[model samples]
Target: MKVSLIFPKLPETSTFIGTVKEAEKYSKDKIEFYGFPPMGILYLATYLREKNFDVSILDQFARGYSVERTLKWIKQENPDVLGFSTITTAGTGIISAEISRRVKEEINPNIKILFGNYHATFNDRRILEKYPFVDACIRGEGEKTLLEIAEKVEKDQNFEEIKGLTYRDNGRIVRNDDRPRIENMDTLPFPDRNLLGNVEYKNTVEGLELSVGKFTSAASSRGCAFQCSFCSSSMFWGKWRPRSPENIIDELSILEDQGFNNLLWVDDNFTISKKRLLKLSDLIRKEKFDFNWMAEGRVTQSSKELLNAMKQMGCKILSFGVESGSQRLLEWYNKKITLNQVYDAVKNSKKVGIDMILANFIVGAPIETREEIIETLNFSLKLDIDFPQFHILGIIPGNWIWDQMVKEKKINPDDCWEVGTAVLPIPLSEIMERIRQTHIKFMKRPSYISRQIAKTLKSRYRQKAVLQNIKNIERWDIWNSWKPFWG
Candidate 1:
């Protein structure tokens, strides 16, 4: 069967915030050096192809296709089955549903529509119930599940026996037993990056395309050991599993040979284990490969020795999940580290000469007061880190926060598939205003300007990023108050 896997395109605009640079679209195009590859769908496509099925991927977000444009492509391809990889942000589920509905009702009634990824995994019953056009949801790791479903589809068979699937039965939704998580990371074939086509992916952190040259992303591991209240990482990817050092190095070597010199380690926390990271760093050095990489890490893992090893092995960017400034909020989020640890981590990262030190802070908790929000903003400003992203606390599904909201009747369980910002423990509008003010204050400082100039002189990558910012100076959405929270 001919299969088409798509990362649904973004809406033309959002009511929450404007783009960093105003354009006709709500997001930047890939040609503009923005966006990352939908690495998940690449796995599905490659796996299906290896099984002798004709498969293609349409990274709609990266391709910057409108709904009409995407449908046009779909109608032309007219694949036997249609699959979507969706996330919880920016109404992706809603968009994917619309596409599915139209495809079945308008394009082809016989084609099967399947959904996967975090959104589909958690809200399978809701999606199948609400959108009859949707054929099924492949929960969790889809490489194996999708292959089985595809074979069933080709044979005109029912998905009743397939594990990790939720589909319609006559008029009822039937959820099969979830498939176990893939335990062996090495067994899964490396995602064929060539399946990604000639598209150019860029690594831009905090509205800054700080990395130059060909850029893509890598996954050293899957899932997180710790469960942060607002995050769905642990739930979406059950438990933690790391690829061996040799396996990770092999992928990096292939990427280097593919002419990709920059990558973002997209693991939930790259430094979850200091010893493992040290081993990986040693292996990377031994390979003598040239790839500059970045990773999200935990403050508790910011040992000086680990930082030094990471830096020596070409880790230019190190970001920490400093979720909040308030100790109370941090604990409430189950983010075990302290504010002191955040400070120490940032300081050590800078001292180790990691080019970009980023801190992610989520403000406006359910019990967070106006004063507490400002305190967090002030905390971000005080940090020695170069980029700090302030997100309004959004309760996403399959997380502790979402469950709490549902229990308290703050959000209706069935209807609210999107991120819920109306908990109203603190008004979302108020938090957004505070975030805008903080961004303005931080960006307008002379010290920030001087830092930019100094960094621009030191690195050509930073120079290119700074030039992009300069060109968009008049249209910078920070002035228009671009609250970076997609949720």
Candidate 2:
């Protein structure tokens, strides 16, 4: 049976920016600019293809395929089963349902529609109940579950015994037992990059290429050891499972040969184990492979030794989730790292000569006082890192804040379309203003502007990226983004 997985576009806002052709052009600009491939879909596609099923991927968001074009592609492919990778952010999950409805109404009515990944995993029943079009939701660690599903679909068998499956049975909902997490991650095949088919992915900063190389993302570890309450990762991924150094190097070696030199480790915490990095460094050095990559680090885990090892492993950039500078807020968030540790981590990364250090700070928590908000902004200025990304804390399905908000009746759990607000959400306008003011305070300085201008003069790619921004330079939205905020 033919299987097609689609990563649906973000829901149309304002009728998708005018005429369909203009909208398509606008979408192409949005899609072609940022984000790497949808690795989850790539893994699923690879697994299905290996099982001798004809599987294809339609990354509508990444490729900028409009609703019309997407439906056209769907009609042409006419797969027996259609799966959608949906996320809760920005009503993308709801859009998947809308697309599924179109597919059933306009294209093939008999195709089995499935929703998987973060949103569906948490709201499986809600999705099925609210949208009757979605046939099933394959919950958590989808590789094995999806394989079982493909087999079931091929044979026209019901999803009775499949683990990690939530499907309808004769107009009644039936959710199977949850699937256990995969312990030995090494057994899983590397993500199939060839399926991307000449997308020319690049690592970009404010639409500027960061280093001008082939860029992709990988995850060496799943989940975070420390479940910071505001995070949804631990809830979604279950636990921290690090792949062996051998497995990681094996993937790296393959990635190098595939002509992808620049990479970003999409792991929640790549430096969870210092030993892992030391060993991986040795392996990369032993292999004599030349590849530069970036990864996220926890301040508590970012020892000088670890930073040094990461430098040896060709880590060009290190990002730390320094959510807030206030120790009180840090404790509430369960970051486990102290203000001093944040300092030490940034110090060590710089001392180790890691090219770029990015620190992320969240402003406008529900209980966050005006003083605390300013403290975070000031703290960003104090850091000697390459950049500081300040964002308003967002509420999603699996996060602690979301649950608290739900408990407090601040948001409805069944409201799958909207990102949940914090327990005591700071008003949207106030939060946006605070974030805007933070950017203005950080980036609009005459010194900072002149410094960035000097840096821009040194790189032609950055100059081009800056030129591209001239059209939208009047936008307040630009300042809201980390890279463009400073620029």
Candidate 3:
């Protein structure tokens, strides 16, 4: 049996338009290239390969789309099954649908097409109804379920027995019972890195001095225990399941041996287990492994002692969700961390020489007063972190906040952006203007802007590039554009 997994490429501007400067600074391109290695697809590929299925992975991000070329490759390989992974909302789904349509129409009509990931998990019914080219959609974690489905498809067996799958039966959508989440992550084989050929890791952006080589991402756990209303992890994974420290260390050792020097722990919350973290740190230290790692966790999860120990154990960076500065807003969002925790965590991280990135405020949230927005900005600036990202509030389809806002008459169901995937009723002009004003206010702070400008100057090589960016901002009038909204 032969199986193929495809990660459809998307326009760089679509993904990183708001953060172009940051993207360019970190990578050689003006956009954040690639979709972070499509870990889910790789996991499924590994499972199929281990089961003796001929599996191949294609990343459209690195390889630009040429329908003729892709179709030619498909025809030449002639895989028995095809699978696509998608994210929340229509962005990835639309791309997957187009590819599926092309395959059905141009390449091979008989090839079984399947979809998985967050979007399919939540919007299976809608997808089935709209895109008939997709033979099935897998809900929730697909590593095991996908293998079962692939076996059935390969053998021409009944697919109804497969759990956690939605498929068309006699012109009706049939959704099978949900599959149980995998508890033992250790049993799963390490991801198939052969899928991503010639992997190189530098900050990718022009001016950054940090060149941690051939970094690979690994998930130490699944799900989040906290109730962050805007987050989809809790809804997707249901409950938290962490891999043992030994298992995690084993995988790290594998990656290290494979010439990957930097590791990114891609868990929703890596700091959930202090004991496990300390144990892993101790093991890394004991093994004398030379690698730098980064992870995202709650702001309050680490202490000065634990952070210091993490640095000693080759942890170079820490990312935290300091969503808002306003205590009231934080409480409303169910972040569960106090303002003091943010301050202390930043202080401790700085003291330990660990780079820090704060996921900052979500602008234009319902009932959000202008004062609260300013307060959030002030809090972000007060932290004095190495990097901060301010994002507009997007009500993703599966999130609790998305449903709640709709129920409360806060979000207009018809309003959408980013090719109808992002929910934003507010005019784009208004949102962009607010962002520009926020940027100006953030840059006005000499201490903060100086570091940011210095970083940009250091990262950018060609003077023309910097000037062009400045000219682009000037033409856009990001600061002054908010006048219509103010009135």
How would you encode candidate 2's per-residue C-alpha lDDT over 1-487 as one tens digit per residue?
8999987777765112111122244444333335667788988898889888998888777666778898998999889999998777656677788789999999988999999988888888888988888899988889999998889888989999999999999899998999998898888888888876545454544333453466788889887788898887887788899999999889988898888877888899999888888999999899987777878898888878888988887887789999998999998888888999899999998788776678999877777887888788788877776677766676778778777767877777755334444443456666566666766676666776685666567645446545756754442234444443343
| Order of quality (lDDT) | 1, 2, 3
Which candidate number has the best TM-score?
1
Cα lDDT of candidate 1 equals 0.80
Per-candidate clash tally? 0, 0, 8
Model 1, 169-215: lDDT tens digits are 89889999989889989877788888766566656666556556678
TM-score, cand. 2 vs. native:
0.88
**Per-residue C-alpha lDDT of model 3 across residues 122-228, encoded as one tens digit per residue:** 77888888888988999988888989978898789868999999998868999999998988878888897777554333332212223245666788888888879
Ranking by TM-score: 1, 2, 3
Off by over 4 Å in 3: 11-13, 17-35, 199-211, 409-428, 440-446, 449-487
Indicate the residue-level lDDT of 322 in model 3: 90
Query: Could you tell me how far off, in angstroms, the CA of residue 367 lies in candidate 2 after the best superposition?
Result: 1.9
In candidate 3, position 440 carries an lDDT of 59
Q: What is the C-alpha lDDT of each candidate?
A: 0.80, 0.77, 0.71
Any idea what lDDT model 2 has? 0.77
Give me the displacement of residue 52 in model 3, in angstroms: 1.0
